[model samples]
Target: MKKLLVIYWTFFKMGAVCFGGGYAMLPILERELVKKRGWTTKENLIDYYAIGQCTPGVIAVNTSTFVGNEIGGIFGGIMGTLGFITPSIIIITLIAALLSNFAHIDMVQRAFGGIRICVCALMFMAVAKLWKSAVKDMLGTVIFIMVAGCSVFLDISPVIYVILAATVGIIADKIKSTSKE
Candidate 1:
């Protein structure tokens, strides 16, 4: 019970402050889950993030669920997900109720503009960290370049890139293994 409550509170705090979606939340996730708590390694968190991206629903919520499930089974997953979303629900409700009254205010608009800038910075930091961690080998670098280029220039689905990368990774691994034998 105590563990569950702690999990809930931790994620609740994250949800409250994690602006700009999943990528922006990565630094907080790393600090709380990986560096501070030692609940999981960076590699595992990245893996969970990747999997979360591929799965249904928001990546932050899915990653929270995966980490909670890793920590405390099904109930943990439930608690984590609830904790992560509860803030959004409350905030959105309040904003919906109040934003119309303030929508025309210059200050409010400026505040939102500032917040957007901050979110962009946070997302860029997250991407830099992910790139440093994930793109190690030459193969990974090649894949990263190709994927980045394609994502920027092409209109293809992200899922297709993920699947193609996974396939390439598997084939490369098999070839490496065969060459050693």
Candidate 2:
């Protein structure tokens, strides 16, 4: 129970301050859970983030549930999810109440415009970080470029890029197998 409460409080604080959506939460999660608390390792956090991305619901919520469960069990998962979402609930409610009036305010509008830019920057940073981590060699670089090209030039879905990458991987493996045999 006490452990669950700690999990709840920690994620609640994270949720309250995390801006620019799910990817933006990663650095904070690393700092809080991995660095400060030593609750998890960097590798564990990265693996959980990857898994969280593939799961249903929001990534942040999924990650909170995963980490919380890993730390405190089912009850911890419940607390973590609730904690992470609590900030969104409160903020959205407040925004919903004030949006109509605030929308007309020039300063608020400007602030939001700046925030949108910042969110884009954050997303770009996440992409760069992931690229550095995932792209290991020339083959990996080629795959990255090909995927980017397909997405940008052909307007291909990311799922198609993933499929193509898997196909390439299989073909490469078969070529190596044939050479060995």
Candidate 3:
């Protein structure tokens, strides 16, 4: 019960201040779950992040659910999800009411422009950190480099990239399996 409360509060704080969407919450989630609370290890968190990315819905909420489920089960998943989303729901509702006025303000627009840049930076930092932890060995490095190139230059869909990577992973494993025999 006490542990569940902690999970709820940690994710609630994350969801509250998280801007720039799901990826932006990675650093905060890591800090809360790994550094502050010691609830999960770095490797486990990275795995959860990767899984969260591939799953439906927002990455932050998915991650919170995974973490919660890991710690406390179904009830934990519910609390964690609620904790992760409550802020966005409330903020968006409030913003919807004030959006017209806010949009008309020149200062607000300028501030939003700056915030967008900072948000991108934060997301990039999270991606870099996660990449460093997730990618291991030459094969993994090659996949990273190729996918990154394709993502940037080829203008291919992300779904295609994920499929390609998975195909390559399967082929590589098959080769490894045959070699050992």
Candidate 4:
């Protein structure tokens, strides 16, 4: 029970401040779950983030559920998901109620503009961290460049890239194993 509560509280705090979606949450996840809590490793968190992106629903919520389940089973997953979404629910409701009144205010618009800038900074940090962790080998660098280029210049589904990447990784691993024998 205590463990579950702690998980819920931890995710709740994450949810409250995780602006600009899942990428923006990466630093916080690294700090709280990987560095501070000792609950999971940075690699595992990145795996969770990747899987979360592929799965249905919000990435942060999905990642939290995966971590929570790892910590305390199914119930923990439920608690973590609830905790992560509760803040958004409350905040959205309040904003819906009050946004119309303040939407026209110059100060509110400027605040939003500032928040967008901050979110961009957060996302850049997250990308740098991901690059350091993920782009280690030549193969990884090649894949990164190809995907980045395609994503920038083409109008293709991201799912295709993910599928191709996974397929390439599996085939590369198999070939590498065969060459060693």
Candidate 5:
């Protein structure tokens, strides 16, 4: 019970200030789960983030659910999900109720514009960290470049990139092993 509460509170706090999206929440999740409490490692958190991205739900909530499940169990997944979404639910509800009335205000538009800029900055920071950690070798660098270039230039789905990268990695590993042998 105590563990569940801690998981919920940690994720709740993380979700409260998390803006921009799941990637933007990475640093906060790292600080709370990996640095502050030692509940997970950076790599594991990254894995969770990856899985969350591929999953069928919001990435932040999905990552929180994975962390909570890692910390506790099914109940933890439930609590973590609930805690993470709680803020969004409340904020969206309030905003929905109030935003229409003020949607025409220039000040409101400016504030939202500023918020979007801040979110972009936050996402860039997260992406930088991920790049540093994930792109460790020449193969990783190649994959990174190819994926980024293709994603930007091509109309292909992300799943195709993931699959191609995975295949490339597996073949690269096999070649390396065979050469060493």
Candidate 6:
């Protein structure tokens, strides 16, 4: 019961402040869940983020579900997702009521612009952290370069990139195993 409440409260705080979605939530999650709460480690959260990306929902929500499930069970998953989305529901509702009146305010526009910049900074920080752990070898570097190039230069789905990377990793592992044998 206490653990479940903690899960809800922690995720509620994260969801409330995690402005730009999954990538933006990484640093907060690392600090709140990993460092403070001891709910998960950096690598585990990254793995959850990866899985969330490839799954069929919003990445932040998916991650919340995964972490919650890990902490408790189905009920935890429910609680986590509820905690994460509750803020959005309330804030969006309030914003929807108030935004029409404030949409033309220069101050509001400037605030939004500042928010966009902050979100970008948060995402960049996340990418840097992820890069340190994800790009550990020659194969990883090659995959990262190829994916980064394609993502920048092409209009392909990221799913394609993930599939290609997974296939490459599998083939490479098989080759190494055969050589060892």
Backbone clashes per model, in order?
0, 0, 0, 0, 0, 0
Cα lDDT for residue 42, candidate 2: 89
After superposition, candidate 1 runs with Cα above 4 Å error: 1-73
Q: How many backbone clashes does candidate 3 have?
A: 0
lDDT of 1 by residue, 1-181 (tens): 9999988998899999999775778999999989988888999999999999778788998999999999989999999989999999999999898999997899999999999999999889888877876889999999999999999999999999988999999999999999999
lDDT per residue for candidate 4 within 63-137, as digits (tens), equals 999999999999999998998889999999998889988988999999999999999998898888778877899
TM-score of 1: 0.60
Clashing pairs in model 2, backbone N/Cα/C closer than 3 A: none
Per-candidate TM equals 0.60, 0.59, 0.59, 0.62, 0.60, 0.60
The lowest-lDDT stretch of 10 consecutive residues in candidate 3 is: 20-29
Q: Please give the distance, in angstroms, between residue 97's alpha carbon in candidate 5 and its true position after superposition.
A: 4.7
Model 6 bad stretches (over 4 Å): 1-73
lDDT of 2 by residue, 1-181 (tens): 7888899999999999898666767899999999998888889889989998777668888888888888888998899999988998999999899998789899999999999999999889888887777888888999988777777778667777777888998998899899999
Give the alpha carbon lDDT tens digit for every residue of 1-181 in model 3: 8977877887889888888665667788788889988888888988999898888787887888999988889989888989888888899889888977678799989998999999999889888888877798999998999888778888788988888888999999999999999
Q: Which is the better candidate, 1 or 2, if ranked by lDDT?
A: 1
Residue-wise C-alpha lDDT for candidate 6, range 1-181, written one tens digit per residue:
9988988988899998998785767898899988998887889999999998778879999999999998889989989999999999999999898998898999999999999999999889888987886799998999889889889999999999888888999999999999999
What would you estimate as the lDDT of candidate 2?
A: 0.87
lDDT of each: 0.91, 0.87, 0.85, 0.91, 0.86, 0.90
Clash list (residue pairs), candidate 1: none
Regarding lDDT, does 3 or 6 come out ahead? 6
Clashing pairs in 5: none
Worst 10 residues of 1 by lDDT: 125-134
Between which residue pairs do clashes occur in model 4? Answer: none
In candidate 6, residue 74 scores what lDDT? Answer: 96
Q: Which RMSD values do the candidates have, in order? A: 5.5, 4.6, 5.4, 5.4, 5.3, 5.4
lDDT of 5 by residue, 58-105 (tens): 888788788888888899998998888888889999999899999889
